[model samples]
Target: MNSPSLVATASITSPHRVGCQAGVQIGQACWELYCLEHGIYPDGVPYNDYGDGNLDPFFSETKEGRYVPRTLFVDLEPSVVDEVRHGVYRDLFRPDDLVTHTEDAANNFARGRYSVGQEVVRKVLNRIRKQAEACSGLQGFMFFHSFGGGTGSGFMSLLLEKVMEEFTSPSMLRFAVFPSPRMSTAVVEPYNAVLHASTTMEYDHCVFVFDNEATYNLCINKLHRAIAAIRVKKTVQFVEWCPTGFKLGINSGPPTVVPGGDLAKTNRAVCMLANTTAFREAWARVNLKFDLMYSKRAFVHWYAGEGLEEAELSEARENMAQLERDYEEVDGHDDDLMDNHEF
Candidate 1:
């Protein structure tokens, strides 16, 4: 048989309780959906004698014939990890794969990137390396993280840098939860978000940005599910160079709602995979906010004390400004270039 194309997923959460809870909820929902789709039980055993779909991408079979998900849950704090350890799907993960640290990043990017995060990064990397070594044909990595929190933004950025250095061939895709000021959790969110984006721009192959405000608005309006994809695509703009930026799929079956979750039952679901330039607008907004706070040197000492230099902040701002321009450039067609010309 040909080598299985394996893809690993890593869910990195911030130290904050809210961020950790959200990460775990999403991870649980994903595990539940995968189990249902592959006809696997919560304990990782086959549901029936009929083996139907391919599970190689997301699962690895053990010597005892149990299939465990190829996923990792990471955080700088252990409370959320402990919860998952005792949760309903506890049997679905290996103990070593769920990595955590005793101390937290304390909502500071510099602390996560340079100080406390460094203490646990090696352990996290070793776990990732172990996962990669098991695959015969490893395809890529999928990261789920929040953009506005310390561990999610700063520690994740540090991890991305290390991953790029260690595994150069595998593509990296991110599912980033963008921050909304209306539902902001911390005063330094803008700083974390901007710095995270600027640092990881080159590391990520593609990113799917999720907005809590948009989701909250959708729920409040009780909008039709069928038109949601269309509305979202209409609002976002993609680059002209990439024609297949948006891919939409309709699943006949309804989404698998998590137990005790607030999501309503629905008949159908629309999933949209996108690579758009619209995220540059979010970067722009955060950068503007960062500048407003940074002009007065507010909260600079916290990061500086944690080993972050003032020059790096200036460089990050410049990097984001250039990134915005790069997006704008890609969105427009180049009239000077002839399609028929050959290199």
Candidate 2:
């Protein structure tokens, strides 16, 4: 129940990571994250050993590995396909995963009759629905897209309405983008944003929204000033928040040195490089708000009765003991260290 089974769809990203095609870069990030998750946890990996009732993946590894998630992409843009097929996305996803529409939906979502987007959306979901029926392991579905664009917003609207009508077993979640003023491409973006948002009120169980400007503007002064970053509970994990700033030091001169090594030159050079207006790293402070989740009672009745069949009460007890052992291991394992301390 702690590590929820994740099946990521797609979302936008900072242009620093993926120049203009931040949307597609999100797919690449998902693949990399899926592959590298084990490395993140020395023992910190999320449990994802579900969803494998012969629901054959889009691709398989060289030596018959059992570790692959079912991936499917529904899109209308041929260029998106070209870039993905030839770029980083191809390195992660195979050609079998693509679920492309013949014609592009050009800002006409309000008029769904004009495009094949809805038809394709229904077809893909229907194909997967049959597969899902064979296995009770379809934990959830994650819908991701930018609200401003026609295809993402329009096709997504169709998905939200139809997915509920089609399947009732898996829970629904959304990773939606609240388009910022600068990045929105369509003139009718206001209508799309409101329409998508209002629609989510009915269909989606939970929606996580990320703003464009908030992601791009990375100033330590605003996000995490140096003193605020490393004061008390602040530690090495908080180093990203401790960035000073950045400056236009690309073509700037080599810094002048003080006669007696005053360190003023080095300091000036650093300040010039990080001149308070540059991008600072975003802090991973999402945990701060998670306390609110515990403030209210959860509808966890279904979760209690559902899970792996082999699990037992003894396994639960051993897991608790393992947590106590992990806390001890964090201190590098001493037999009687803090033995006299009060629990």
Candidate 3:
């Protein structure tokens, strides 16, 4: 038998109630889906005795034959995690895997990265290390977060930096929810998103950008089927040195929408795994917004008060600008070289 390729997932959210709910709900949905796929119940018990599916990628068997998810739910505040503790799928997760703090990030990226977030980072890292040690052959990490929130952007960036430094070999994939201007909850979202993007750009190997406005439009305007196509040969562009692109997969059935969720019920669904230069568009737009505020130095004091240096902000802006140019250069290149080579 081949060694199990264990992939640990971390669901981190901002201190905002909405962000927290989104993250926790997504985590719960994924756990439920995994259990359903593997013939396991919500309490971690198998449905029947004869099922032989490979559950090692996201689960670990306990002494009582119960399967626990190799997933972690983290927040800067305890209310969200407390819900998980009392939730229906509570039994599926270990108590130590749910990490939280008494203080919140207060919608400030600097606070999340430098102040309040630092207090719980060590404990969270210890738990993550224990999870890593339990795995036989660890493959990589999958991070679920939002770019618009404080903890999601700043705290997640810090965690990604540390994880990249320690793991080194495993590929890191991010499922990042980008903020929409029309639906934005916080004014500092642009700043948080840009800074987070610049900080974690080099750390993440692959990122699937999810836009709230775009998804809403797709669901409202074109409601028949969920078909999102990105042509790698023409529309998509990848970095020359890195293995980056998009992989399209169409599931046979519709997505399982959680109760009281915002998603619309559909007949079909499509998922796009991407690490393309096209993501630079998001960076560019957010950077433009960042410039609007940074030009006036609006609300810069909040971050500065939380130990963020003026030079770091400037550096983050420049880094994202440079990244956009890098993507443009990659996009201008011919696909001939990539066609002949293999990643």
What is the TM-score of each predicted model, taking all chains together?
Answer: 0.83, 0.52, 0.82
Tell me the TM-score of model 3: 0.82
lDDT of 2 by residue, 1-343 (tens): 2222334343222222222333444554555454443222112232365333322322222343433344555566555656656763354453545556666555433432225465577666764565455333556666666665555666677766776787675587666565555655544444444445445456768765556566556442244445444344333221255544222445344554423443454523433112121111111111111122313422222212222112222243244344445544543424354333121
Evaluate model 1: give its lDDT.
0.74
Q: Clash pairs of candidate 2?
A: 41-44, 218-280, 245-274, 246-274, 246-275, 247-273
Candidate 3: regions farther than 4 A off = 1-21, 218-269, 274-278, 333-343
lDDT score at residue 83, model 1, on the 0-100 scale: 77
Q: In model 3, what are the clashing residue pairs, if there are any?
A: none
What's each prediction's clash count? 0, 6, 0
Best-fitting candidate, measured by TM-score?
1
Name the candidate, 1 or 2, with the larger TM-score value.
Answer: 1
User: What RMSD, rounded to one decimal, does every model reach?
Assistant: 6.4, 18.9, 5.9
Candidate 3: lDDT of 162? 79
Please give the distance, in angstroms, between residue 227's alpha carbon in candidate 1 and its true position after superposition.
8.8
lDDT of each: 0.74, 0.45, 0.74
Rank list by lDDT:
1, 3, 2
